[model samples]
Target: MKINRNFDNLVPSYLFAEIASRTAAYVKAHPDNRLIRMGIGDVTLPLPPIAVEALRRGADELGVKETFKGYPEYEGYDFVREAVAGYYRSFGVTVAADEVFISDGAKSDTGNIGDIFGADNTVLVTDPVYPVYVDANIMAGRKIVYAPCLKENDFLAMPDKSLSPDMIYLCSPNNPTGAAYSAEQLRAWVDYANEHDAVILYDAAYEAFITDGSPRSIFAIEGARTCAIEFCSLSKTAGFTGTRCGYTVIPKELVRDGHSLRDLWYRRQATKFNGVSYPVQCAAAAVFSEEGLRQVHENLAYYQENARVISAALDEMGIYYTGGKNSPYIWLECPNGLGSWEFFDLLLNEAQVVGTPGEGFGAQGEGYLRLTSFNSRENTVEAVQRIKKLLSSSV
Candidate 1:
């Protein structure tokens, strides 16, 4: 039996794994260094109290036969789905409860969503994109096209009718760059998708981190319901990284080739997947509760302040960068003409701080670096001071 050799075409190592490997090697060689990792975008905050309580209550229900649940509904429980739908409504976007499909995480859904489409379809993805979008399509052996997200457009890729791609992957409050699209910018893509019969896979994983006026959901844009499938995670939103719960919205209006995409996704999940655990769904639902929202926002403000510390440093140093305002990531151009990996090594060796090299994202990401605000306030402040010292001494 032959395995899918398409995997052979992937990069030798995942971006984060390589980072971990290098960091590990450094610590082993120089045991004296105290590394403050501002690399991987994992959340450092604990889960909100409301969610924790919900999890405890849900788990306790399993102890009693009357309340015990064997398996969740394939699309998620009505209560949880309603909570998700209610969340959209809060942001001025209307999403039906039935449109939500509970999943382990947005990462899983984003990669697995490609299953419903034929391998022959062409995929359009922004440069310096989240790697999953590119790698998933690569694994499927689909034709992949890159839309250049250059500095001129502020790293927000607009629709180009000339490309005619079948599937478009858009991540706002983008992962590597942390750039988000405006409602008007998103409307252009929505209209373009409807015009070309293409489907947009919109990743709103960082939506909760948005403080600016950018649209939180693609559904806020007119015509998006006809052509967009939105994926969101409680990972960044409610610090559910460890718990692992997310949801995907496939609108009933999105029918392609005489098949409802929602129904297609439902069938796909039911076949290859069991639903998320009841306890986890209960915890996720709490993320939408009044108290849950307050606590999550408090945590978000903590991270946002961390972002301010980092962004303020970049500003004082006269470094060119994007994000860090409405995003937890600060994407900056490397100083002194250093390459991506070069900057990474310099920071690790000199300042003992860790950051993600942008080259891991795409070709356009060369000479750039990504710093996350997911660390503690003290660490964030110290990291900035260290970075400042490094740059000052270099000059």
Candidate 2:
């Protein structure tokens, strides 16, 4: 039996794995040096208290006969789905509870969503994207196209009408680069998708960090219901990265190739997935509650402050960058024309700080590096100080 030959096409080493390997080697040799990691986008905050209490309460119910839950609905329970819907409503976007599918996280759903589509479909993604989008499609042996996200466009790739793709992947407050799309910009994409009869897979995992009314959900655009399926996660929103809960919104109105994409996804989930745990769903629902929102927002604010500090340092250094205002990432150009990995090594060797090399994301990311604001405030401050000292002296 032949294995899927497509697997051979993927890079031998994952981006983060390579980062970890190099960092590990450095630490192994220099045991006394303290390394401050601003590399991975993993959140450092604890789950909100309300969510913890809800999770505990749900777990307790499992002990009693009357309240015990055996299995969850594949589409997620009505209450949690409603909570997700309410979240959209809070941002002035309307989403039906029936349209939401609870899942492990955005990363899983984004990768798995390709299962419902045919392998013949061409996938269009922004260069310098979250690796999952590209790798998943590659695994399916789909023809992949890259839309370059360059500095001229502030790292937001707009659609070109000339080429048509069956599936499109977009991320706002984008991973790696951290650039968010404006409403007008999203409208352009929505119109393009509808015009081309393509499905846009929009990732809104960092929507909680959007402070400036930048259309948190693609559904906020008028034509998006016909063309966009949005994936979001509570990982960053409520510090649920370890807890693993997220949702996918497929509009019931989105019917493609004479099939309802929403129904197709429901069928896909029912067959391959058992559903998220009842306790996790309980905790997820709590994230939308008043107190829960307040608490999570406090944690989000801390990260935002970290972004501010990093951005301020970059500004003082007269460095060109994007993100940090509406995102937890700072995508800065490599100093002195250094390549992505070159800068990554410099930061690690001199400053004892770690960041992701932008080239790992995609070809367009070659001369950049991605730094995250997911570290502690004290650590963030200290790390930036180290970076400032190193860059100032080197220059």
Candidate 3:
């Protein structure tokens, strides 16, 4: 038998390895240039005090024989699910506690959710997308298709009248490019999905980072429950990156061909996965606490400031960009018509600031760039300054 052939065509290793090689070469040649990375979208903050206290208390409970939690229920611990359900309510969305499947992060849930779907489904994604969605569908052997999301569209991806797909992926306050869909836009897509009996895998990992009046949940749109599964994470919401906890909401009302996706997902979880650790889950639960909400929103405000800084810099340079007001990423048009990688090299070599090239995201990302606000405030300011200098010199 042949080894899984899909592995042979995978492209990330080559792409990221090339990024590493180029970054390494730059560092070697310019050792004195201090690089401030705004790539990879990693969290720089520590766990909040509330989460920390809960984590410590949870560990202490585990130390007692009576409170030790062994193998977690595949669906997840009730307390964590209840807390997540409550968290949903805060946004005016209703998700049942039993419908919540706690996992490590949104990325894992986004990729692994493909295990339950049929291989023959047509998958639709934004042109310049988060990459995980398309790659996951490809690995699952689905017929993948794309929709262009460019400057004219404000980089908000939507459905086309020309196609109907069985599965769709959407990231609001999107990852690499940081574009968010308006409620009206999402409603239209929901309408399309409902018309076609398709499933929309809604990713809201960066929803907590949105500052504008944009809806934070897909459920904000009417009729989403009939055709949507939303994945949310505490990683961006509450600095739980290393802490490892996220949840997927499967509505019981989501039925197709007399089959319940909620039940299928329950079976899938029970067969292949054990739940997240109790202490870490307890920490995630704490993220819903009153104190935790205040602290985390403060952190998000700080990150929003970083986005403000980057977007302001872009404006001063007269560069066109999307996604600063609502999300922590600034998608910019590459000046001088430089190719994405060439622009990446120019920024790396001249400015000593690292940002993700838009092409790495997808084909429609060919002439753009993505810089994140996940860096420290100091670094964000410094990087913007460096960008100004580089653009001034180049132009």
Candidate 4:
């Protein structure tokens, strides 16, 4: 009859939920208003042709008993695992097929991976991080402490060598803030985790969206395999938002108390998950194919253009913002001294557009706002135009 106490301390469902509810109410009352949303980071593109064909082929295989795969090898299809390993190698990061654990989504893996370690472990996480990282540790009853990732830090959290935590969570091309860590900054974290015998949970889900030369994978840093686990997802990369396919890289070299993390994650997946559907795995594998990679890049290029459009608009008006150069998100300074939510409301009421309020992310996110470049090209251009008008009028 007792519910977990951590549930009591947890904040309400994400900020997007409230935004949806508010927008829904307004639409119900004023059906004439056309709401152009730049809030949720979900991709609005279709799966590429190569991936689509792969999915269809997979479905055909399922139709024939000769190829109908039942209860996939808990680790996932070997073809897919090999493809992932190839990806790491191509990027100058070494990983083995056995080190890759396929999952339904990064959101789920980030939460379920907690089962591997004891609850007493200290979790050092960043403030204003992807909520899943922080919330999961608390749910597991772990000791959670946050290292501030404020504007002063350029939102790239660093290691506190003086206080080593058992586990650390880091996200690059960060959600909400859109800040990507430099190579040196990432190496410092890798060294710290290795020195302290700690693990760094590196979320590089947005790597495919990175346009400029940036370390797309944490494994780019030396000694990362000794101290880090990397998470990547296809949702943003190839428009799989609803398709839901992601992978976690558990290096064979990483160990704690003489137990292998790679082996542990394998066991965890075997017990709890039936790999992604046969069709999904096949589709994901095809993503590495020459044609698949080509088609996917096309979609990526389109979204990156949207980022440029939004960022350029902000720049022309002399508004300060970060991202667009390397990621699909643009973090803008809310006008004047308005609180994030206050600015959110102002945009919705005056401009008929909606953006995410950074304050809803965490305490450090106050006075900031987030806008995603995931809308249709036409809509994205229109949204930028409307925002510029609102800004000029307000100023």
Residue 300 error for model 1, in Å? 0.3
Report RMSD (Å) for each prediction in the order shown. 0.7, 0.7, 1.3, 1.2
Backbone-clash count (model 1): 0
Candidate 1 lDDT, 1-395, residue by residue in tens = 99998899999999999999999999999998899999999999999999999999999999999999997888899999999999999988999999999999999999999999999999999999899999998899999999988788898889876899999999999988999999889999999999999999999999998888899999999899999999999999999999999999999999999999999999999998899999999999999998999999999999999999999899999999999987999999999999999999999999999999999999999999999999999999999999999999998
lDDT of 2 by residue, 1-395 (tens): 99999999999999999999999999999999999999999999889999999999999999999999999999899999999999899889999999999999999999999998999999999999899999999999999999999999899999987789999999998998889999999999999999999999999999999988898999999999999999999999998899999999999899988999999999999999999999999999998998899999999999999999999999999999999988999999999999999999999999999999999999999999999999999999999999999999999
In the range 175-243, model 4's lDDT, one tens digit per residue, is 878989889999998889988989998888899877667899998898898999898899998888898
Clashing pairs in 3: none
Q: In candidate 2, how many Å is residue 53 off?
A: 0.6
Model 3: per-residue lDDT, tens digit, 1-395? Answer: 77767755567464456777888888898888899987667788788889999999989999999988798888888988999899889988888998899998898989988888888889998888877887777777788889888888888877898998998999998866788888899999999999999999999998987766788999888999999999999988888888888999999989977889989888888888888888888888888988889989988888889999999889988999998888878889999999888899888988988878889888889989888888999999999999999889988
In model 2, which residue pairs have backbone atoms overlapping below 3 Å?
none
Off by over 4 Å in 4: none
Candidate 2, run of 10 with poorest lDDT: 171-180
TM-score of each: 0.99, 0.99, 0.97, 0.97
lDDT of 4: 0.86
Q: How large an RMSD does model 3 have?
A: 1.3
Best of the two (1, 4) by lDDT: 1
Identify the candidate with maximal lDDT.
Answer: 2
